[model samples]
Target: MTTDYNQIANQYKKAKEQPWRTRTELYSMMNLIGDLTGKSVIDVACGEGWLTRELRKAGASEVVGVDISEEMIELARRQEAREPLGIEYRVEDARATESAQQFDISVSNWLLVYAHDREELGVMCRGLANRIKPGGRFVTLITNPALYTWQSHPPDYRKYGIEAQLPESAYEGAPVALTVHLEDQSIVIENYYMPIDAHESALRDAGFRDVAFHNMTLAPDPQVGDEGDYWDHWLKYPFFIMIDGIKA
Candidate 1:
């Protein structure tokens, strides 16, 4: 099953305040991680660190945040002892994280869909390209493997509060679930379903390169309204998928 997330750590941190997670997965992973000032991030599966404290408030001179879930790194070390953005949480295991110092950017929003196949998605894409360095970069979000061709009807994401299910056929690892919807309760989370060419052949066999795959953006001043057409069915169909790469 492997979906313990430490007993739904605070219901997945209050379901990340679902609003399509900031209008679309943290605005398409911070606009593909444009700037981080001095850069040096890690954040793989960083559950309770809230984007690893927004990558050190986006000035990332350095930041860390792993998560094999020790109660979600103890609520990201209790919000870093209440509020001291020096981030550094860790419970480890983004496929056995082993950072010796090699970051410039290596986020992992959904943590490679929790790889259950394709050789554990190439050991989670070589542990997200061994924490990046060569050209540094790796942003992620994964899960839209064509969403299993929308098995029949499927498109109703509970008004973005979230909901997934899937699995009447599609296979490669299968097991989907998801479900967030938290206002009082509802946190599922159990992912797996890889095959966008097995995530671009597990990120070019773990060395990464220009790989790309994004589609979900909306927040150019969108607090949500009919003005944005209420995110037009989540911008057509994006349940999630934003992978980028570089690290070679």
Candidate 2:
């Protein structure tokens, strides 16, 4: 099922506040991104622009956030209006995204999994590759293909505020349902599962090289007490993963 992010924009934004998002997901992605001083960045599937604003604040010379949902873009714009970060927000589909200016780096939180099949995934990869300058970098978070069949049953990550279930007869491009549980409510997000090799091949076919998959690493946080014991399962088998490649 195609998720109407427009209808769940507010809930999804609130989901970003979940502890695991910052302590692990964002931390892992940012570590892979490294420095951004004076660089230009394009954030595809930017959603509410939380990461987009962070990119600008990280000293990016220019930042543009693109999302397929108008409601998501509107929320991002409203946040920009209040803070005046000089970021640009656009409503566009990742498969069709064509930035006016190629960027030094392109980042996405959860774009690739939207592709229902290899063909659509290739289109999304090519679009991202085109928006990045030659030699630039591409970083993204995606459903961990490694975990798709690593366990007989899908993981129950409620301790981290998210739940994902894989079908008993899972196959390539199978739909996986993920629910993000906030303090007060929960939001369901639909994503597709593709194997690790499939993702690497698509990136390479789209002009990327040195494609790498990074495991989730937890940053020490006083807020999340006893990080090691609390995040053991996640460190061993994360629900999502961070991947990066250099545009060739």
Candidate 3:
């Protein structure tokens, strides 16, 4: 199914007030990447430029955020104007970025999953690598596919005899509402699932080397659960996996 960029843009605009778990994961991953002072960075598929803004605050000299959604880019531009973060937000497909061999670092968070095939992923990595100097870093975050299948169970035809299992939570709890496409009176939504091996292999084939996988676990909070609950259950079995590699 085609993703409706307008719907995604609207969600991002509203998400500014919500506490997104993925954003916290991205922040932790950024810290692990070390200092960004004076660095030229590109945030690929940068929806609403939130992470791009954070990168600018981390001392990146020039931060460019690109997304396929024009409305999202507009929102990002407005936010940049209000905050004056010296960031450039553009509406550009990740598979065809404009810059050529210019950026010091290129980062994509939870964006590669949008690629439906390996060839598309190769094109995106090539595009990202083309914009970065040789020896530059390409950091990406993706959901673990193994975790995905494990969380989503097959439909029991014998019991319910349904044609398809209505898409439900593929994660820990009930599936959250992901605005996919909106028509005059209805919206189409779907669940997202990914495997870590698919992500690593794609990066490797895209000419990235020394790839490393970092399993990220969120810190336990009183609202979520007890500390030991997170450490024992969630931390031991993280839902998100981050992969980093250097462009060859």
Candidate 4:
């Protein structure tokens, strides 16, 4: 929760399109989201608003990008100013943000990973659910619970952006750090280890119905190229877990 992405924003943005993000995570999540034509979307923890812009290009009529980091918001705003997308960016905590259920869909990339405890998890889910129309969905791409808990080092972990060196080892709500290999450098950030059960409980308590998790796949994509088959071990354990929460 204390990770300073502002300090590494430029490096991260530059590496955001690396296979870990663009190829596997975003590629899978966007597939799950399908077409957004004519839909209004709210992107939580939108960071540089890259995905927000993509949503607009995908035909989202209106989009709002929210983040707790002012630096991230500033960068997002600057980009918007340079190339207008009509996307609104705001600095708001994911746990406390209030809206009038105006959005048709809510999506977050690495937002829930900041929840440090049950209370925070509950708050996040509630806030996400509250921002969307009834029956609307909250789709999140998160660090996979299975991979986070899996202790053994996979042979192809690095290929999938996982590091064998874990900063923390304990299970269930323990603070952990993940190392991501980028082109020029590596990045590590602290994220709480919330198990799948805990995530489900929090979502259910927050009034979400039919919480389903779609495991990340090694499905071929333009970004992945031909080496996808080499990382069978990576696909066996999901590096990212996609969760769909329907507001009840």
Candidate 5:
């Protein structure tokens, strides 16, 4: 049940070579968080800092990108050196991140679903809430449980029940690994497929106010029309969800 940051780092390092959806997803997340001009942001589960770099480019004054993977941090550092922007990358667990620094906005893309359960997810949400200034925002992008339930392979209704779908894959070839949670040991991480209502309820329980959910459709970049048709269909029936709220 240990969170293998190394495995995640390795996966993300090879992510850039994949198709355009990766970039499209990141862009979609950025859009959900809105303009970043002159704001201090914390990117939780930041992976190799791709989104952090994008945030800087979008005019965020400062960004702290934190991930659980040391190897990912190393790669992120290396990438940052090539295009020096005022972004800082750190290897830290999302559930236990403790920094004196507060932020204007806290964002987690594809992170919440990986938490062990509602308890662990709530802990992370509360931690992020504590790290933001009043009136600041917390925005997250997660795999839509409904979409996973509808499209997952084998259509195994027993494990996940007919009401929910278990995530078996993240991309075309990448098989999603199964994880088991242990109370005293490091919990194996996997997506917690919950409906949108459950997600909003959990966020509210974590002390966030005014929770809202959005269905984001990734638009095909006119520049990459047919090459990005898969993304077009994806957007039409997006497999992801965007949620945002403010700290009370």
Candidate 6:
């Protein structure tokens, strides 16, 4: 199933306001990133430039946001026009992006799952790795491949208002739909279900070293989005996993 994100760009932006995205995934992704102070960063598949703006605020000396959808890039450019963060948004697919200088750090959030196959996944990984200079790092958060075997049992992260259980017919790398329940609405997004092993192999083929996975972690902050105790149940079952390593 080809997901034309351009059709759902607005909905995707709205979905980001949900706790699962604003709090859980964002916190975990940024945490795995450690620090961006004085780093040159690239936000791949940067829909609407949300992270591009935040990257500059996070202290990246230079930032670039890239997405394939012209509509997505246009929205990002609109944000740049309003605040003028000096960030650049290019409408090139990650597999085909280029620059004179590779970035010191590249961050992609919940993006790679869009790849339709292992070959495409390898292309994205290679492209992202090639964009990083020596001593640089690349990090991303993607749906946990463990869910592929969830033919019946579902992850116990309902408290966080998110859930995904593969049906009897679903297989790893197959298209899957996830419903994000926000305070005011519920939206579903399509993502290809690639297993973690496939991701690891792709990264390795792309020349990323020390590829490691970390479960989502909750910040101690009591007041973030809604239920303060939501993470208690959410922590037991990680819906997503963080993968990061040094660029080779």
lDDT of 1 by residue, 148-193 (tens): 7864345787877887888777788888988888888787888988
Segments in model 6 whose C-alpha atoms lie over 4 Å from true places = 97-99, 149-152, 156-165, 182-186, 222-228
Sort every candidate by TM-score, greatest first: 2, 4, 6, 5, 3, 1
Of the candidates shown, which would achieve the greatest TM-score relative to the real structure?
Answer: 2
> Measured by TM-score, how close is model 4 to the native structure?
0.89
lDDT of each: 0.83, 0.88, 0.65, 0.79, 0.68, 0.79
lDDT of 6 at 120: 90
Best by lDDT: 2
Better of 3 and 6 by lDDT: 6
Candidate 6 similarity to native, TM-score: 0.89
Instruction: Report the lDDT of model 1 for residue 60.
Output: 86
Candidate 1 matches the true fold with a TM-score of 0.33
* Per-prediction TM-score to the true structure, in the order listed: 0.33, 0.96, 0.76, 0.89, 0.78, 0.89
RMSD in order of candidates: 16.6, 1.4, 6.9, 2.4, 7.7, 2.5
The alpha-carbon deviation from the true structure for residue 61 of candidate 2, after best TM-score superposition, in angstroms, is: 1.3
- In candidate 2, stretches whose alpha carbon ends up further than 4 angstroms from where it belongs are 223-228
Candidate 4 lDDT over residue span 120-180, tens digit each: 8889988888788988888988776665455464223776555644444546666666777
lDDT of 3: 0.65
Q: List the residue pairs that clash in candidate 3.
A: 145-194, 145-195, 145-196
Q: Select the stronger candidate by TM-score from 2 and 3.
A: 2
Error of 4 at 57 (Å): 1.2
The order by descending lDDT is: 2, 1, 6, 4, 5, 3
Cα-based RMSD of candidate 2: 1.4
Best of the two (2, 4) by lDDT: 2
